[model samples]
Target: MPKPSGRGAADSSYAAGTGIAGRGVLLDVGRYKGSDGPDDSWLPLDANPLEEAEPDAAITLDDLKATADAQGVRLREHDILLIRTGAIERTQDPNAEWDPFGEPGLTYSDDLIEWVHEMDIPYIGADNLAVEQIFQTVTEDDLGEGRKSLHGNYALPLHGAFLRDLGVSLNEVLDLSELAAQCAEDGIYEFLFTAAPLNFEMGTGGPVNPVVLKATDGAGEEGGSEGRRGRGR
Candidate 1:
């Protein structure tokens, strides 16, 4: 790793001119690619069964490109990307046995990093924490506790690529179900987005509740949960 750089949550801390702000693009991958096509239009019925592998699946660059084409949404530079995988949704059922060690999400890829860098995407987030999948596949290999994220371990390479190398910020664990519903109904995937952490100097990370203000025929809507997900420095 690159030495012990003290770039904690304080770096991108919600300061006056700093925090994250820009067009937010929602790529509901869980719907279009992560699951069995859209159920009646972009989301499976709440009462219906959730998509399997919400536990272990990779949202690859190919899936990303296909989602954009399916939504008819154009990718914009400097855009804040929020990918909804519905992985979290699967675990919502209290009766289901769930393990947090590994779950489905975006995995690392050289091409993806290149695309993010080239597009200058300032931030990327998802419904799952760790944004990048810790377990690369369906069968989670127990890499001994805490050893999975050890320095030099390729488990969470994107964490290093985007945050460490390209200086792109990352945030996660957002409740994007409501947001997904809104987008599918309106067919508008772009909106004004902003988020920031409570500035606690030198803190590793802090909680953030992203705000979304949408413009739809002069009407507006806001959807998000007050959740705790640390933001990268």
Candidate 2:
């Protein structure tokens, strides 16, 4: 796990405004990867080829923007971005190989970092264990002379970039299949999202069950409590 450079939600002061409720957009990368196959397909998360592939197979920021545009969804400041990468679906397969050290996720690059900063979203969640691809190949040249000593050190760089630098909280290992199905059925991508984490003092992180509320009439209401309800993994 990555350490926070500053105070986190675990602090007493941070707990006051920890509960976030606002508009959320679900970017179903699984659909972009053809996981549905014209029919609702549910497979183990690791079984998904996109999630099991290497960093080269990771989704890019432009892919997300294009998908959002195609789905008629707009990215706004402070929106909670829920990315469905089909990671939870992998749990259905009992014989799947589990690799804690590696998993498929969003591509980690300066462009992605810049995009996130520009979007100004407070929280970003993904169905995968990590928000960015793990064990990415980094050469000594890639690290440059000053940072060459750190080459080959496995780390969650995105976590440090987002949580530490940008003050963005990352939610991972979410089961987004149900939410994705609901969004597809209604052709609605935005919804009222809220997450309440355990108030562990001085804790770096804790568990959270994110609640997603979508309006029955297809008009998303911010902070609205009534509608179809879905929980996080």
Best by lDDT: 1
Prediction 2 TM-score vs. true = 0.73
The TM-score leader among the candidates is 1
Clashes of each: 0, 5
Q: Which residue pairs collide, candidate 1?
A: none
- Candidate 1 C-alpha error for residue 150, in Å: 16
TM-score of each: 0.74, 0.73
lDDT of candidate 1?
0.65
Off-target runs (Cα >4 Å) in candidate 1 are 1-10, 14-17, 36-56, 137-153, 217-233
Q: Could you tell me which 10 consecutive residues in candidate 2 have the lowest summed lDDT?
A: 224-233
Off by over 4 Å in 2: 1-17, 35-56, 95-98, 138-154, 217-233
Candidate 1 C-alpha error for residue 72, in Å = 0.7
